[model samples]
Target: MNVHETEVRARALGLLRSGSKNADVARELSVPVGTIGYWKHLDRAKRGECPGRHDPKCPRCDGRGLDEPAYSYLLGLYLGDGHISHYSAHRVPNLMVTCGESWPGLLDECELAMRTVFPDNSVCQVRRTGCRNVKVYSKHLECLFPQHGPGKKHERAIVLEPWQQAIVDAHPWEFIRGLIHSDGCRITNWTTRLVAGERKRYEYPRYFFSNKSDDIRKLFTDALDSVGVEWTTLARGSDPFNISVARKASVALMDTHVGPKH
Candidate 1:
């Protein structure tokens, strides 16, 4: 390995010793998480440690890349709640190049980025198509012929919207809030009632019921605060409520607590 490669490996080992998840370390280091496993194996060998017999021609070592890198990159965008349709060869090539790394580090970095960007949940692969070679069309061709011609054999290209990109760019809390609001679920009158007067506090459902909600709420508040939004907490019964608004901020603070209404 070159000097840079050695440095990266050393940093990775340090991260592993620090109890960082292998997948997280991989992503941060832009390597495959499985590479960590290989490193461990190598380490054991160097120390005359014996691990059980393992496959010699593992796909990763053989240079046959795994889907982890691509998965990790997408995970950074989705945070475990978005859809991925693999029909765009042009787009996929760029993504692969950008995210290309060994599985261990790639997976680790992807997960870490997800946690930092969206701590509420891990990125989930909702859908995936078969692994097939896709043709990357030139930009000029794409612009000139936006639609697929009759002779095209490949699947249709997938288009991601600006809102989707926004979710990818925002922190986890912001992403979750956007998802929730985008669902178009009507706010409950009861939840809104808490914000009407001094009863600003509200409790979420059971811990299990709210799952990722609390984390998301905290994240949103942090984002709000960064923008100079003044906020205060109120107590209503046992529940806690947050009241915040931006200074010279146009976005209205929703006074309503989010909950299911019967």
Candidate 2:
């Protein structure tokens, strides 16, 4: 194994010896919490304490032939997105092990865990069309990206796929040459609904195109309305909302205002 993985394993073993819970070890190490159970099983096997069939008394749940349900429960949460609330971590495991049923039960267990973890947080499900099928993902927006948050300047966002990237690149005059003066721009998944029941959604990154004119806001708003898409204006001072349509609309608006090159 690599140095990092070795160190993580050693640290996990140490945490177990120190009476630390698996969840604590996982969070502290930033590794999937389920790994602690795996190491413990390995240790039990090395000691020859594991059984040949249906062992039921292993203290670490390794040789007991029990399902090590804790590992599966924790794995699901980690795979779903390790953004659980700090408070919920302590109680979620117990509930999962005790709860019967299968996949749906697991989902219900997670939903309960999420509610307990983020009492005030709001959750929303977004559906999108993919090449293979329509897929749905759950997302939670904590709030507008903080103006002065640390790390990378931009918030955690979904990366665009190749086709989406192509559409974005085709409008390079607006995205690359116009909106951002930096080396490149990023697309975010933040959406705002101008009116209820609108079929199309609008994405707004934290930045926008050029900051040239005062009437740019109205111009863009009018353009979106002209195309039958409603929009909400965010007061971001000189920064334009980092959205594809906004970039496209802004380019069109600027062209109209400045007129075609003679």
Candidate 3:
């Protein structure tokens, strides 16, 4: 390659490392996207960063299009109540989502989302005292869920990656449903009101999502905002750790999409 070509390749690699996709890098450099991929492949080879084996199931590793809606839902579940752990003996990773036995429908939905994301992988449920652990094993769990790391999710920063944010943007309701399924509830509170002369019972429905992580709460509320749902943050003592949606229109929207966890 000529000097100009070499400079363009270097800039493309920098952009890719900075989270720019191949098409974006191509547009910025005024080069074909295929050429950008070629340069990236060559750069990885030059740096000896190629993996010994590649899993085609991993969208990031193999450049396959992900099932964004399913992924968005799964991502919400993950951020809410899911965890990833590696087997010490074999290094294989497992992604587990804790689902309450009370909501068997939610448990089934969680398993379905996992299967949609990893069609070839096996999803199973392990019974716990009051919940079932819906889990799937995959070598590329880390690739799918970059948030997997040491410590609890609330203990660490829970910012979503750019790609993940895109998925959430495209399917905010599904994402909200997943989060609500995992850590939220829909309840009705009633009170007695005097209408003219007679006392009447009035009931109002609300949605509440509770998570200890401030970042996760922000993400949930952000999604709510995107879908024109009004939410308020509730504090426990001095710590703000809950989001509530009680506005009539917002509640109707939630009922249309999420409803109660069957």
Candidate 4:
């Protein structure tokens, strides 16, 4: 059915079947290499060969090393404001983290962490109303993020594997930074104080992280504790959903490392 003469087609097929590379066969037959590849692909398909089955670089499946600090930060972001979509086993899943448009720097950092974690895959940004969904496509996303599951993260039990915990234990500040960048904020509060016979205004800065999940809050606070940053729980009505870091020393530590999101 191809345009070439029947004899030429038979010769090409014969050369291909004899283990000749497409480029060599094309040079010998005076044909485009792509045509030779196409013929080979068709031949394979007719013989029941599956298409596009290959291994990508994956830490868990391929026994490759991971960037632990980046993984720790990405894990915090995933726990705070990210999700993985799995359509089927034959297709790769997408990992997405929502970042506010106001903080372009945070978006860049999020994308960088994703790229560092999955160096062989592609990372992209999808714009939404007032936010951007920074995403990466990888076949091994679930292997990296075991916290992925059904329903909302808060509804399900969110626990880290031992290896993940060890990484968090080593890079606690990066983990806290990722969480703060996602669901926390650094703000200033001011009040009038009597200092010299006249009322003077004084300002103090603090960091606050709010999440509906008790386990997530505990994880954040635990990381803070590991790094010697003091934190307290603030209750809104009956639900204690806020973690506040207002102590002078703790605020200084946070300011030095995870300052206000830009």
lDDT of 2 by residue, 1-262 (tens): 8999998898888887788876688788887433455565455446653322232232222332322232223222332222323223121111111211223333344434433432332222111232111111112211111111223223322333353234333332322221222211334556666576765677643323322233333333333444333344444565654233335554455444321212
> How well is each residue in 1-262 modelled by candidate 3, as lDDT tens digits?
7999888888899998888987798898898554665566556546754322244367888776688999999998998899997756323467889988888789879988987998766456766789878877678888889988899989999888898899999999999999999899999988999999999999999999999998899999999999999999889899889899999999999999899997
Model 3 residue runs over 4 Å out of place are 1-56, 89-91
Best by the TM-score measure? 4
* Model 2 worst lDDT window (10 residues): 131-140
- Candidate 4 lDDT at 8 equals 81
Model 4 score (lDDT): 0.85
Q: Rate the local accuracy (lDDT) of all candidates.
A: 0.35, 0.35, 0.84, 0.85
TM-score of each: 0.21, 0.24, 0.77, 0.78
**TM-score-based ranking, best first?**
4, 3, 2, 1
> TM-score for model 2?
0.24
Candidate 1 residue lDDT tens string, 148-243: 233321233333344333433443334333323222122222243445465664433211111123433454455445534454543456555333
- Comparing 1 and 3 by lDDT, which wins? 3
Query: How much does each candidate deviate from the true structure in C-alpha RMSD?
Result: 18.2, 21.2, 16.7, 11.3
TM-score preference between candidates 1 and 4, better one: 4
Off by over 4 Å in 2: 51-262
Worst 10 residues of 3 by lDDT: 48-57
